[model samples]
Target: MPRQAKSAAAEVRSLREEIERHNYLYYVLDRPEIPDSEYDAKMRRLQKLEAAHPQLADPASPTQRVGAAPREGFGKVLHSVPMLSLDNAMSREETAEFEARIRRFLNHTGPIAYVAEHKLDGVAVELVYEKGLFVQGSTRGDGTTGEDVTANLRTIRSVPLRLRAARSRGLPERLEIRGEVILSKRGFAQVNAQQVERGEPEFMNPRNATGGSLRQLDSRVTASRPIEMFCHSSASLEGLHVSTHWEFLDLCRGLGLRTDRANRRCASLDEVFAYYEATEAKREELPHEIDGVVVKVDSLELQRRLGERDRSPRWAIAWKFKPRQAATRVLDIWPSVGRTGVITPIAALEPRNIGGVTVSNASLHNMDEVERKDIRIGDEVLVERAGDVIPYVLRSFPEKRTGKERKFHMPSACPRCGGRVRREPGEVYYRCLNVACPTKLEGGIKHFAGKHAMDIDGLGDKLVHQLVETGLVKDLAGLYHLELDALVDLERMGEKSARNLLARIERSKQTTLDRLLNGLSIRHVGEATAKALADHFGDIEKVLAAEPDDLLEIRDVGPEVARAIAEFFAEPRNRQQVRRLLDAGVRPAWQPRRGGKLAGKRFLFTGGLAAMSRHEAQARVERLGGAVATSVSKNVDFVVAGEEAGSKLKKARDLGIEMLSEQRFLDLVGDA
Candidate 1:
């Protein structure tokens, strides 16, 4: 080998060791020595070196975290040992009963040491290693067999590809480490923001996001997400011995695997309860989502002696925190028409305080969800606030229900416009088919003049409602032909206000193609998707003429979204409305500027912009041929942070992505 090659190989080894030490400090010890930017710089240097000299790179290098190719699909892998579920203890009495039962089963009254660890709300998986090299990983499908997700697991940086050698003993010949894949609260928020930007359904919580990311057939997609793992237990192992559960966790940490540092070794059940109480008190502050604490027998001998049940182990019990639920009588079930015309069932409830918020209503999600939960009018139902924001009906108690409880049936006609409603094939939502429904029209017009859309200033919700209610504005085209005198006659509208509104509306007609597409209120086409469509097709006529397959060729346009766009354009009424709007001087011009200052860069803005509104900043970026992203990712070129910037700013700093203040951003865009 050349001298320079040898030098590069030595530096790579040194970098890997330093990086692993930092990972251990940050993940296992919960103590970081350096700033995230400094750490990221070291990582980038190692990655650049490894990329330049692949022959000198090691498989265990940190740069190889998300380097795997996409897999076709997950395969089935049988667990060597079964992964049993834990029995739950919902209350203090239940927990005491569980301890008494364990003592009775063991026929012993002696004090038993226990290990209490946070019960992470996430997807469980088993990672297998042979000769200290990571080999396979699988989900806990049915305890006996699981779907192999080795490629997806490899994408998580916290899961070391190679285990470190023990100081007193040789490397393990075989090991099966069990852990939970979690999306942190910050990561979940970031992912949901991306989902909303792409017009996809947002996941309910971090657990759902983790599960969905693990199940992706394409491993590359999983690689893009920030997933984490914490090894809690071992399914099987060889060439190692640990008499206690805490000792096993220590061993895991020594082996370059992440273990929760918050775990406590309790000498008695009282101590266990104390640990549980302490953990529950700090639950909301934890980065990852945890629902409860798991208490287990510390001694391996005692655990084996207690033995396992058919579904759960006798040695372990999960003491769950009380779910944030409140009993409320359903006053009524009403259908709400969304901008996309989907009718959602909402339950008006007697106001109850849940998770510190007084919630008066809960979403039934759809008719299917309502039916599954058997929710009825006047029925006493338990409502839970998912992620402490959206309230949902958990279940209804039929035995406690009064005779006045009324069964809710899907309305045959739309409630707002009395139009026909139909459920599409393979869909759970019932949609109003009438395009002219007043509810949908009102929603569409509101969205069209929204800050993120065409951004017509002075167009408030009241004005839109009055225009729709009085039949003054039948469609978007009607806005272009509105007379100033008629607007001045409306409630709260004067001559100056009417003239300013007219000027805003006229100025909105000269928007770009992306804004125009967004203003059209097409189903599943959000601001990001609209920008992608406009960038790809460049002309409105081209986009209209494109087939579903052609639309699918663009990034972020899935089959459902492509079909929605095609079906929307295929409607005769929609086509006529578009033609009328075009004839009314709604010209969406496409001007491609090459090599502009911000061209081809992706920018993300968070917090409040003091100098300008977020919509104005986005428009400026778009005018410079740049794109705006909703989440922080490796692909983002810069984050334009403003006042009170939150998680996105932290994430950008962690990834070593550039950041700009409002003034700096304006200078870059030549607006300063």
Candidate 2:
């Protein structure tokens, strides 16, 4: 190796060791030795060094944990040893019976030593290491075969990338350890809080959150989550020896695998039951969620004698606690319309706290679930909240249902808008087909101002909602007519912000025909169809004049596109809105393909420009019959790089693509 390469390798190894030590301290031991900022700086430096020296790249390096490019789908991994499931014991009698069965299998009358541990409410995964360096990881899918999730698992800090050396022995050549990947109660809450902030759906429970995180196609997403793991058993332990399960777990911990401190070694069934009782009593106080206690015969020899039965091991059983459930009355059941127009029944419960969270509402999924559960207003219902998610009604007490109890039926007319709702064939959901529904209109307004549509700046979902709810904006045309005072009065909209938004709205009036058409959100009309229509017609008037036959003549415009276009234009309400838009100074125009203005030119932009926003510049290029690209390449004719230009500018210059400043671009395009 070169001298520099040798130094880089040494530094990489040093950084990896430091990062793993910190990870063990923070995640496994709950004691952070270094400040988070300092840790972050080290991670960034490590990543930079790794990127600089590709030959020194190692999957076991801490820098590799942030994840990589998204995969299309997960590859299948067949487990060398089948990942078995555990049979459950719901009560003391059942647990005793399980113990009796194990004793019968072993043919031993003496007190059998057992290992008891928390049955974590988590997803099971198998982590494989070769020569004590992490190589592969997978989900426990169907035991025998699993989805490969090595990248996602590597993102978890508690999962060891490289095993720590034991003072007494050499590292294993190949080791496969099984563990439960979990999210703590606090972590689940934090994740859900982020979800609400992002306007995405909240996960139902910690297990649900963990599962979703693990299954993310983009491992970067998994890296962002608060996920941890606890290794409990081994599938393969080459070059390692232990007499009992308890000893194996200790060995795992010594090798930097996170092990549960809550585990207990019990010499008899009485001691196991005592541990279960204590664990169940202090369950809520535990950092992570556990539904039961897994009791396993400690002796590896005894376990072998009392070998596997079906998918479960005869030596181990999950002695589960009674499910956490509470009784609550259903105050009311109402139908709510969602973004996609599916009408779901939401039940309002008489406020009762379950699993440390106050329960107010539960989604009944559909009318089918409501009927199946026989859930009715004024009926007492048993509710179950798994890991502090919103409680679901387990079953309604039919005997307690009074004559005053009301059965909910899906409304014929939409609740949000008085349009007819109908259940379509093959779908259980009842949908309001009306586009004019307030809920649907809200979704449309968001799409209208989206980047691919009008490219309107500062007009987000929250602002649009405020405009609609305040009755200041009713339709698409209403946006153009928004007064400064009205916008300023809306939530979170200061005068300065409102003015910036108004300026963007004004600039959007000069958009190309394609963007304007796309902003309309006509059914079956997407970006490609809109562009085709714009290229064929060039102006709004010609597009409005073109019949279905004329539309069908265009390339890529099939019968469906033609029909949708015809229907959109034919509607009087839509036509009036288009007219109103034109009156409000919105002009939609484009150059025809045969014309020779700036045709065949491909422009890519980077950084801030003083003259105009990037979208406006792109629109101008398109109007003059030029094409716009987002990346730098030799094929691109012009790279319109401006102030603070980054890597793309250098790349464009290197590739010999013509570079133009804001002024040069304006001069070339005739300053339109």
Candidate 3:
């Protein structure tokens, strides 16, 4: 190894130790010697250095943990023991019925004991252990089957790879525990901030973030995500003798696993109801996200007596809190175009608390959302913020609906550009018929300059707005026509900044095909679609000539996406714009072929790699000419199995596809 490489390795080792020590102090001991800002700066430096040199980074390195990259698709993993969904008890009557059912099955005389814990609103995953070592983990895909996400699970520090206590060591030879994986509020905020910095769409809630993180193909990416898990139930077990669910939680804690500390052992349904009431009152005060309370039969023997019903275990019931709803009058409903040109209705509500937050605004989602809720301009309605974050109105109060309240009729023309608006058949959204609507132009420019799209630095939302408002930029192609002087004339655009923006714009003209496709901001054409288009077309002009049918032929491209792509290309004005862009020397980037020995073979990764970051590994494989698939199938040549390899690995084995260890997979890439 080079002297610089050895030094870099040492630096990473030192940083990891320092960070780990700090994490122990902060999270476990609740003490911190270093200031948070200083600690964060050091961590960022470590991340940058490690990202630049992946060879020096270890799997346990503090910089390698958090969230993973998004997967291409999710694969099915048939659980060894099915993960049962919970039965919901919305009222006291329902809870009584659930109790009656248990009594009918068990023929018990005394009151049945129940254990109640907060029902976390997040993705369900099963962690399998063999002799206290995390063997596999998977998502609760379709209850019986789920996607493998073992590599990602290993990245969670709270999840113990080995159980402690000399007597408890390997107490269970085989075990599978079902749990909820949630993104912490702190982690979600930090991740969202990073996303904002990168110009990517923010996840609406922690549940969405957790679900997205678990399915990521790159364990390294999963490691970076702030994911935590709470074991709820035992799906399967061997060599263990716990009689009650409450006792089981004690065992879990003894084995160095995490369980909800808020869980209470209730002797009767009255206690359960009281527990629910208490949690409901304090729900807003809780740091993590909890939708409701899960009440389960405490006795393991009694649970077996209750059994299961179709999709859910009859032994457990979830008492859902009412949707945090409030009565509020709609001030107005306004249309806003998204980056992809999808027009959305935003309801301006009378300032009131819905859920916990004081909500003055809520999304109507689309025309469907508006109509389904029967929302009107001036009518008083009930609005709810599910999980206390996203707000949506339910229905208008008939008594409060005065004759003066106006029915909100969606306009037939683009409000800003006077262009005709059209609603497609069977679709709920109304679109701007004019391709060159200033709203669309503004959105297009923003997408073009976005970090995940064109990555054109110096051109921001304010600058794009200025260019669009001034009529200097009509479309993405108009960016090339900009000069430093034109930019300087805009407010806040200094000479140096203007020159920088122009230079960045000029450089963006030469971006790769995927980036160019993303920059175009076609409806339903997101980052994934853009990559698929680039891989298929290999050039821009060919894509313009292709029909909707041709676009539909690509894997994962739906009819809506195809229609959007075709519509974008069919416009003469759009074609002219493309021509102008092409004429300005924007050449399409080359599509690198899968040329090595594993060229035709598809590989899907699950679980954490002990050595390399997922991004580094993916780049390495792609560089050597290998196709990295998102989901597992029979056609997959190999599944790269890592620590906690989940459902995908099992599916691969079931399909008789070869499975490779992380080290072996790395060796293959190195050979290529």
Candidate 4:
């Protein structure tokens, strides 16, 4: 073997050894001997060397660790152990009934103890360990199945790569713990604020951000994300001596796991409610977002006797906090134009805290919301975020008016660009006429580089902001025009990173029509709309020339949407932008024609489906060329009812719309 080959092999081995050492110290012990930058530099060098000499790279290379990889989509990995959801009880009466049911099942008339804890609003994941070392991890894809996220899971600092158990406690020979991976509300705000400053689209909530981050195929990107986790229960434990759930948690704590300190042992239902109420009040004050509290039977013996329902555990119940509504004065109402040109209203409020987080602003949705609520600039209004995140002003408090409040109206022009803003007929939002407003430009460029859009591998928000602020990128077309040297000159954009980014930028020109359409930031053209458009028009050129009548004829394309598409194409600037995007070689991936299986078949869903959630079911139906209506109309074909079939069931029967049970609905698609 050549001397250089041997030297390169040794270098790769040493880098792996160092990275593993740091991983153990940082991920397992929460201690690091080197700064993050230094560690990253070392990892980068290893990556470059490995890329040059593939034989020298290890499969377990630290460089291989991000959460995404241009996924066609995620596949379900059936869990060896089921991930059961908890039943919920909102009031003391229901809480008492939960306890009584457990007692009845156990046949114990004497007494029982319970454990209460805050239920973190986050994504559920399972960590698998073998012989004291972390081996694999996956998302709770569908309770019984999950997507492999081992690389991304390895990036969370609190998740230990190894477990230690004292022989006395009977540590399992092999172990798997199911838990929630949550982002701190503070962290979410900080990250999104940075993105906002860079003219990038911000996440609506922390859970959405956490979910998107965890699904990234590249571990390096996932590593940079500040994700935290809390273990709730053990899914499977082998060769372990734990006899109860409480004991199991204690053992987890002893192993240096990051468990909640507020988890308490309760003596009665009264005490449980007290804990729940206390947490409910302090929940907003915590650094993280929590929707509610979970109470579980403490004794393992009783839990075993109580067993579980088909979907939820009988041993535990979540007490969800009602949406916290508070009265506040709306000081002003203003519209912020996004990169996509969609104008949205932001309500400036007198400072107040809802669920512990300070509230100064809330989304007014659109012009209709403002008129419906009769919200004036100085009106005292009720705001809420209890079950739904993002505080919303509910209604006006007329009693507090004192004739001092003033009526408010949305602006007829873009505030930033001084351009005309028009609200499409029958649509909720008004849109900015200016295509090059600084914020819009920044947002569009950011979208063009996002994971779901252009997938430009190395262009983060910070870099994109620098480019725009430095006047390097005037529009979306500037991305394609960037030279490697120009990128390399920028801070943080090294030679390799610049080259990789440029390559991705070049490759992105060949992106699908759906991705490009979604990236353009068009009003009402979300991922679904983009997909439909791509399917209707095979390429960007055809889409640009499509007439309103032509578009309205397409499946899922309504008259209003078709008009929006036509209006967008009617603008000369919008046409010029399209030309630039094409000149820059950005290709769009367009899906081929999909048969409309449920065409002319209107569907309504109430409650939840056994095979999928209501939202999931709706999305699946639309994907297969179907329409979901809020109400059962004369044109409706099927109403899929779940376990708790609501008012929609009766209404469906009254309207004579065909109805399907959960099983029947599943069978229609062969999903049962």
TM-score for all predictions?
0.65, 0.60, 0.52, 0.51
- For candidate 1, the per-residue lDDT at 61 reads 77
Q: Please give the range of 10 consecutive residues that has the lowest summed lDDT in model 4.
A: 193-202
Query: What lDDT tens digits, residue by residue, belong to model 2 across residues 1-672?
Result: 899879988998898889999988876667899999899878877876787789988878887788777999999999999999999999989989998998787777988999999999999999999998998999999999999999999999899899987558668778999999999999998776555323345676799899999999999879878899999999999997889999998888778889998889999999998999999989878888899999999999898899899989999999988887789899999998865576879899988877668888887777777898889988998888775456677889999866999999899999988789998776667888787677766767777888988888787878877777777878888889988988888888889999999999898898888999988877656677788777656678766766676667565676866887898899899998889989999988675564437755667889898988786687578667766666665446789889999999888888888888899999987855
How much is the lDDT of residue 380 in candidate 1? 95
Q: Which parts of model 2 are misplaced by more than 4 Å?
A: 1-5, 326-331, 335-345, 350-382, 394-672
Deviation of model 1 at 664, angstroms: 37
Clashing pairs for model 1 are none
Q: Kindly report which residue pairs in candidate 2 clash with one another.
A: none
Report how far off residue 372 is in candidate 4 (Å).
16
Please give the range of 10 consecutive residues that has the lowest summed lDDT in model 2.
193-202
TM-score of 4: 0.51
Please, what are the lDDT tens digits per residue for candidate 1 over residues 158-209? 8888888866866788999999999988888877666643445557678888
Instruction: List lDDT for all candidates, in order.
Output: 0.84, 0.84, 0.76, 0.75
Of the candidates numbered 1 and 3, which has the greater TM-score value?
1
CA RMSD for every model?
Answer: 12.4, 12.6, 14.4, 20.9
Give the lDDT of residue 33 in candidate 1.
Answer: 100
